[model samples]
Target: MDNIISKLRNLDAYPKINEDFYSRTLSGGVITLSSSILMLLLFISELRLYLHAVTETKLVVDTSRGETLRINFDVTFPALPCSLLSLDAMDISGEQHLDVKHDIIKKRLDSHGNAIEARPDGIGAPKIEKPLQRHGGRLEHNETYCGSCFGAESADDDCCNSCEEVREAYRKKGWALSNPDLIDQCKREGFLQRIKDEDGEGCNIYGFLEVNKVAGNFHFAPGKSFQQSNVHVHDLLAFQKDSFNISHKINRLAFGEYFPGVVNPLDSVQWKQETPSATYQYFIKVVPTVYNSVSGYTIQSNQFSVTEHVRTAEVGRLQSLPAVFFFYDLSPIKVTFTEEHVSFLHFLTNVCAIVGGVFTVSGILDSFIYHGQKVIKKKMEIGKFS
Candidate 1:
């Protein structure tokens, strides 16, 4: 009992020593608390960075059949190859062959075997007449006849006797007589025939004739197949212009069998088809891999790989992750593709930012308050000892 009382009385005399010890202890405590909070904030920040590295993006492609194929995947993956993709055309079916005749005859012939000539009266001419009309005539006994007519009697009013004079007059005026040589010249010149029959009939005319030799059926075959890669994501989403060529022979006469209502095959057919279809369907398979690293408190995402369909006619577009990140490692690690996978990363990043912000502000305020308190407490201690 005496020893315990002696210890209690000596405790009051040790105030200076106790005061120094308490101040040191409080300072250490504050430092330790601040350090712990900083560590927690760093951990949260790291978690947020991991979430930002992995996101999914959309992929799309246009095909030759005017079809569009869309798929969702990461942006970092490569497209697939063509042979693995399949295509089945629904509209064209069955096998049919078309036959056409190339040999055709083109000749001009008259109604009779013998080529006819113009008559002396400038009528029924096998050759075309120049301005087909008669201009001049002779008067005989007050009756009109051709300029070569003769009178029946030797009368003073004989217009036939004056026929020679009128004929000469008309000839001098550049009028054409019924000359056999002129008619022959016109016939040999290959002019279009304009003939007046001996019965005073009208002109005769003729035109060309055409014949068609069509086959019973038509044929269709598969065209060349190709693959395209490194396609831009924007081009696939909208309509685009594209073309491909197919080498094949088409029969001229049987062209109607395949292309109905086409008048001329050589003129109407495009030897090579232009403007491929703007829509396509694609089947994309994607594998996502992630790699993350932390260097000096900053996290970064690395490269990734992907497999996809790359055929022009069969499939288009590919699959990939929208975003990706690694967690404290540099080696690539495989990850499963999921629709809701981004939620966790988003939540973690946000929480880290919030916690980091709060702790940083609190530390600043606490540091100021601790420094002020220390100054005032030191003054109080000094005054007590004095």
Candidate 2:
């Protein structure tokens, strides 16, 4: 044990000196005090860094399957009436949602942009009692009341009970309901009268859409949607021809749940119609993100980059209706964030290094100063220095 202890002492990088050879001076004392203060400051700074946390970010391929994406939207159409505006969504997966009205809220605003009424969307006026009597009063009480789709019916038993149902049937058959005033259900429901009442009003529509985690587009357009020869179209004849303002403002549009520091580029986006009719489009690329905080809190959200375009709609030249369309695609890679604190062992090692390094440097500086002063005093005594 004695031999081992001697060998360890010989290996020491900092050997001790005898007290008899020690020298003290005012300059040496000043240098020691200064170094001690500097080391103390450095230690405090390093300790603070070790106590706090650091974040590491990474990107990896996304392997999620069968997951759905939720899109939240708040849009204000300052010139389109709620009676004629509709929402449609379709995806590359062959899924389509037409005339979406569930889980939606609409605020009716007058020409002055003041809110006049707020109500749940898709609510039609009260159904007309005894609609058959209003038609002709020719049917018996025992007979089953079968209304007409006006040559647009798919079967003899098909019925159109409300004005909306008649229009829907006509849409399915690729025929426009050009004359709502002529249909008994429309006349009884006062469909034409409702349009006249909302002539100069606008609509604020807010809703959420759930879809597959894939590329897709959803739009807000005037008139109901239909497909003809593999092309999507809307019943433009149902809208007033005087003037249709396609200008719109998007209050909020988010892809998923809210997270800290999340920024969506499309929020508060507004577009004023420059042409008589035009289409506004947004193309977006979405990147999935996962954040893990130092306190073990986690957030799963998304980030996006976007580009926009506007196209003028030429009248009577065969074109799609003026609308706002959002098209988005997903990136294969995802980002992750992790938080961490410095290790105890690392902090201890750095503290020791700061103290030892400062002390050694100060000792060297003090020795040089003392030796130079002694040499100068000897030279002055010999009359070799002034």
- Return the lDDT, model 2, position 383: 94
For 176-233, candidate 2 gives per-residue lDDT tens digits of: 7777878888888888788889988999999899988999999999888888887888
After superposing candidate 2 on the true structure, give the runs of residues whose Cα lies further than 4 Å from its correct spot. Answer: 1-53, 112-114, 123-125, 133-146, 293-300, 314-320, 346-386
On lDDT, the leading prediction is 2
- TM-scores of the candidates are 0.17, 0.78
Error of 1 at 139 (Å): 95
TM-score, cand. 2 vs. native: 0.78
What's the lDDT for residue 85 in model 2?
A: 85
Model 2: how far residue 280 lies from native, Å: 0.5
lDDT of each: 0.28, 0.85
Looking at model 2, residue 297 earns an lDDT score of 91
lDDT tens readout by residue for model 1, 1-386: 99999989898855555554444447557766876787677766666665554433332231123321111111110111110111111112221111111221112123331223311111122222221112232233534332222222234442322322332233333232333223222333322132212111211111111121111111111111111252111111111112212221122211111211113222222122222322211221222222222221211111222221222333465432111111111122323221223466666776667676766776676677788888999999999999
